[model samples]
Target: MASGDAGVLRQVQALFGVGTVVGMTDAELLGRFLTRHGDAAEVAFEAIVRRHGPMVLRVCRDVLGDPHAAEDACQATFLVLARKAGGIGGRERLGNWLYGVAYRTALKARAGAARRRRHEQKAAEMVPEAQAKERNRHDFAPVLHEEIGRLPERFRAPVVLCHLEGLSYAAAAGHLRVTEGTVRGRLARARVLLRDRLGRRGVAPAAGLGALASSRNALAVPAPLIEGTVRAAMQIVTGRVAPAGAVSAAVATLTQEVLRAMTMMRLKGITTGLLFIGGLVSGAGWLTHHALADRPEGQQEGQKAVPAVEVPDRDEGDRRVILGTWTTEIVIPRAVDGEPQPPLRLEETWVITGDRIVTAQDEEALKVGAVHESVYRYTLDPDVTPKAIDLTEPGWGTFPGIYELDGDQLRISYGVGERPTEFTHDDQRGPFLKTLKRVSPDPRPVTPLFATAPGGSWAIHPDDPGGATDKLTSTIGGVVLLTEDSPDGSLQVTLAHPVDPGAGPRPEYRAVAFDEDRRRYLLEPTLGGTGGSARGGVRVSLQRFRMDPEVLPEEEIAYLGVEIVTPGALLMEADRAFERAEAAGVEVLPPPRVGEPFEFALTTMDGEVVRSEDLRGKVVLIDCWASWCSPCMAKMPGLKALHERHDGGFEIVGVCFDKDAEKAKEAIESLGMTWPQVLVPDDEEVRRLWSEGSMIDGLPRLLVLDRRGVLRVDCAPEEVEEQVVRLLGEPGQPKP
Candidate 1:
């Protein structure tokens, strides 16, 4: 008992005279206690615990599989009740609410335990024989409880009420507030699930479940447990002292877990609601910040900014300064083959007209068979850190990006399919960064500023994004050329490195051009080239040009990205490309139709080649996923259950799109996924299958195929089991 008030404690003791609580309804006792103030509240709280603690502890014990842990979880449950006692509303059955809370609390503890012992889980997988030896020592009750706890929430509740607590069907129904028939039906279904799960673990269910449900050998709740829990819960609830001991720590952990779960659920709800609202108010800039709060830069609010990116420039609200040509001076790192390499310069010109941004490369760009450019109508949200920039290219797609412009220095980064939250070069296929020095006076030379020009180099600025100064130069010709010098002078390289025609087409490189009519320096069309490998990693750049700026040394940074082609010319190029694709008979498939089979073959994580055709005789669930996808991970348990239930008739093919093979393999092993997992090494192919073939825009995509290899459903993750079961029960074999 708490040592506070003697009078209130004595009164509470009199109210609960020796076993007096036995006949009082839980709500009545709880109401009596809640009505009291101060010290009396603590006494009444203890009375509530004494009445309900055993049952809550029992449920926790069943769920958590350890008595000590159960007591701790039990304390945590009452602590929740104590905190929310005023809201008990006097209508709910205290037992039922506590039961649910206890179950969830215990479940949370189990998840924590699982996370802490994840390494042990890996060991269990690697040494299964040792696991078998360990499980052999435990009786069936523990195993039975483990299986029961793993049951879906709907089924598990009835099983706990009707079987463990020995509630009659009507009583269980009353507690669960369901029809008696519903209670009975759920218990029957629960039994079947439990039996199946236990059978897989090599435990004979008939004997174990019978013993588990009966009161023959139930563990007694410890005598001091109720009072200890009440005292601990009261101390926690009142906040008079800090929680102490293993039990106190457990209470803290469980409370934190429950609160964290509630917080996340609420956050998701808020995010979803905000997203819906964002749809209605498309121009609401705050929505973008909130929506991206879960992403990278938004996640790192108030932290030190990454070295690769600068803080957003408050001046970017006026897009006029961003209108001109910006060129990149790059320092290519030494090759993996240990060959010394010189800096490389690339340039991009963005000509802003109203809301539209026309993108062009320098005139010295390496061009191959065709000239290409793009026009994007853009929007900028300047309020957020690493301000959000969205660009929509007509007939292509929207490119989301972030930008930070510091005076003449401009850094803009963009991703292909998704907006980049950070300026990073880690994901080559994902996002790319371009830093430009704004050039003025149309730096494209009508007359070379070099006067009497040789290929002599100009010095790169010390503050350049490329991080090298002595290496950059541009040589003037009828066509301007940018070059970098090796430190040893072993090689002097120009931006026009030769590319083999046999290889795939190269992305455009920066070049310079003179505008005769404007008589100002102008940004050039990119020089297209044949194949060299795409620079898979970060490249720093410096540019040598035909003209030195009229200003002194620091003014070299003033070169701007200028418009290279007219909108009419860009439209012509897009039309030509479209015509070429049309001529090739390109037929882009939409997301695949349900009940239509498509052929695919890929290498499994185990290095075995597997094809859809090879798995014709079984029901196949093709799970297209990536490790980073939460929805995909969330579906694993259901898929695993389905795989287990229909082991002989069904097969699950996990098409993992993870770029990191180790993480993908570890997920498979940790999830204990026995299904054959296909690892798609090529990210582009994985994305194509997801976006074009599967037609599913998100991860955790599931495709069901009948026995004859015909796809039965192109379903969401939640629909996987239902579709799989329906397909398995279908009458005829599908055509291969």
Candidate 2:
């Protein structure tokens, strides 16, 4: 804890009946806080952050890719756990539990982020200036470490824990709730793929395979990579790099390179020359021949082009294959006639350049990110005989084969692949050394259905909302599906359309889990047919409308979400039970829904007393806030100002939704808040209230009550103020 807080804590502990708090450990102070405040844990937790927040934040940020999200998640996770001083199982295990909480919270944040990305898409790259400034921060080692973050969450999770997180194969397995074998297989496959991809980029494995054996030790992404990356990241105002149209970009770069290599000498003199033209044709053939040699599944999903590693690089894939080190080996195909492949330049370079944009909300700052870049180059011998070279690995799914040979065409094939264990070895005719071509047999067929609030069709007018079945419906089937309909799904809007022109004209797709044992799908616009609302996964991004638009004749969009799974409402009771909790000095999230007629309730840590409900008809505003919530904190001054401005028409009952209630309460007081504050309680009743009632998972919410004690407004502080002013009702309305 900060030295400053130690002094203040001593003062609070010295208060009547309470022994000196100055010398207490964080755990002890926390115990006293729960024992004293009950629901006021929010206030105390906030105070705790003011004391030792930096350490917590540093750990969270380093573990999670996003600092802002990490901070918010840390605060929210703590809020639910605040009152459980004794329940933390014990102080010694605190760090472990905290790590578990951090991990889970980060995962949820990542899931939620799939939605936010729409509003904040960025190209993450640095400008020259930022790159220069960060040079000192990056670490570059002879043996660089890499992790497969882009793989499915399942694969990514295990690999990250074992590699980046530095957990033993067994220990990592334990944490992931998987068996050690599963971990080994996953790591083996992941490492193998990483090597291939690195080779494609013309980068040699950073270390020999033998290194993995020696390191029976898990992994730590070379510190240099981390420092260098972040250092490069920090220097720029913005680092977003937008991608060029995929089909166009991938084909043009890959095909053009082959053409140049083949025709460089012939075309050196003239663009209009006949010799030059002939060379171009030959080069195009070579390009097609080489690209087709490493065909991934027919179609590309999120396929991208990467730069080859540096030209003067000394690393070679052949050298490290035996050592078990993960390395990139760009293996060109030799002709069946036993001839060496033609000359090729395997490139491995980090492409650094991106778009720039000021922060949308606060223009003074910048927010930038990008569509990460990776490149793979290939070559073939002169015989035109096809030789096999493995480009993809087992388990790793495939993206569409994007090909563009010497500008004749940019072809994007359908996405296809079986699980790694399910392999299909086939021999195809020679692809001319000229250009790549993909022939998708036919778009897969599917059947799609529509869902509404009433579980039927399209709403035509979604603004007219009431429930899920309040819309119209239809279905589609057996049509060519096309590209994904949405980039980042916030509203599940894409689910309303065919996954692509290839999946099927109809709308039937898969979902992660079942809701009422129903088929998940979408509706499409076929001629004049009405479309349907949809449902599907965000990450996997599959779409199959249950009610295919072609088959349904009509359809509507549907949004299915949860309100509260539990029967008894928590907010309804938070205020009715507040009085006693408040008197004991516990802060609580305000519930404006059930106003002055009732009070919120809470139990102390030791259950010595029930506090929240007994406070009084206090027009209590249980402020559910966090130290890391900018929006929540941003609205604080207005609340304080309103409290002071009105001179106490209502009592400001501050309740922190944080882990360390004592700390939160201290922060509350430090802010000059004269109101009584409470925090999370160790009592089971209070825990049930938060976990079951109100059904909240976020912060900075305000609950207000009317003088007559009716639930009024439950919103942000600013929103609450608006409601409060309106509730005052022009100062002339009759009161109950």
What is the number of backbone collisions in each predicted candidate, taken in the order shown? 39, 185
List ranges where model 2 is wrong by over 4 Å: 1-598, 603-618, 682-689, 730-736
Error of 1 at 52 (Å): 4.4
Judged by lDDT, which candidate is best? Answer: 1
- State the TM-score for model 1: 0.32
Q: Worst 10-residue stretch by lDDT in candidate 2?
A: 363-372
RMSD of 2: 30.3
* Per-residue accuracy of model 1 over 453-496 as CA lDDT, tens digit each: 01111211111111011122221111123332121211122343
lDDT of 2 at 322: 11
Q: Residue 161 lDDT in model 2?
A: 55
Candidate 1 minimal-lDDT segment of 10 residues: 287-296
What candidate 1 gets wrong by more than 4 Å, as runs, is: 1-12, 16-33, 38-52, 62-66, 84-97, 107-156, 176-182, 196-208, 211-218, 240-254, 273-736
